[model samples]
Target: MAEAAAITWALELAVIEMFEHICIESDAKVYVNALAATIDDCLWKIRALISMSLKLSS
Candidate 1:
């Protein structure tokens, strides 16, 4: 879950960086921590997907 949250945060940052001006908001601290936990098991796949999304968005 931590991995997922980190991926989400990364993706959000990527989008913000790509767009230049935009407000990103999230109220789920638990979800954010979930992504930051570790890139193990299925979390790695989630991270890959987020990375791909950022690349495609860019």
Candidate 2:
């Protein structure tokens, strides 16, 4: 869950910095898969973070 939050925070920072290109990698498959999963299908704990990450990445 923390990993997902960090990912979202990093994305927010990147956007604030006006970065045109960036790469994010994580070894936490749980968080990675949670982000890839649909919001409804994701665990409740990380759902909001995943949604935020999606919006930021888009």
Candidate 3:
């Protein structure tokens, strides 16, 4: 959960600044996979942030 929140905040910063590129590194597979999961399937509290992160990926 801490990992998710941190990633979310970083993503939000990137979004706000209109950064063209962003990279994320993690040692936790579960949280990483969860963020990469499809929006429709994810049930985590950070779903909104996950969706935003996914959008940034594309």
Give the top-scoring candidate (TM-score).
2
Residues 1-58 of candidate 3: C-alpha lDDT, one tens digit per residue: 6777777788878888988888889886666877656677776676776776776656
Per TM-score, what order, best first? 2, 3, 1
Model 1 lDDT per residue over 1-58, tens place: 4544555566677776786544435565544343345434324535665445445435
Q: Between the candidate structures 2 and 3, which one is better when assessed by lDDT?
A: 2
lDDT tens per residue, model 2, 1-58 = 7788789999999999989888989987877887777789888888888888888988
TM-score of 1: 0.33
Q: CA shift at 34, candidate 2, in angstroms?
A: 2.0
Error of 2 at 37 (Å): 2.2
Error of 3 at 34 (Å): 1.8
Judge candidate 3 against the unseen true structure and give its global Cα lDDT, from 0 to 1: 0.74
Give the worst 10-residue stretch by lDDT in candidate 3: 35-44
The lDDT, on a scale of 0 to 1, for candidate 2 is 0.86
Global CA lDDT of candidate 1, please? 0.50
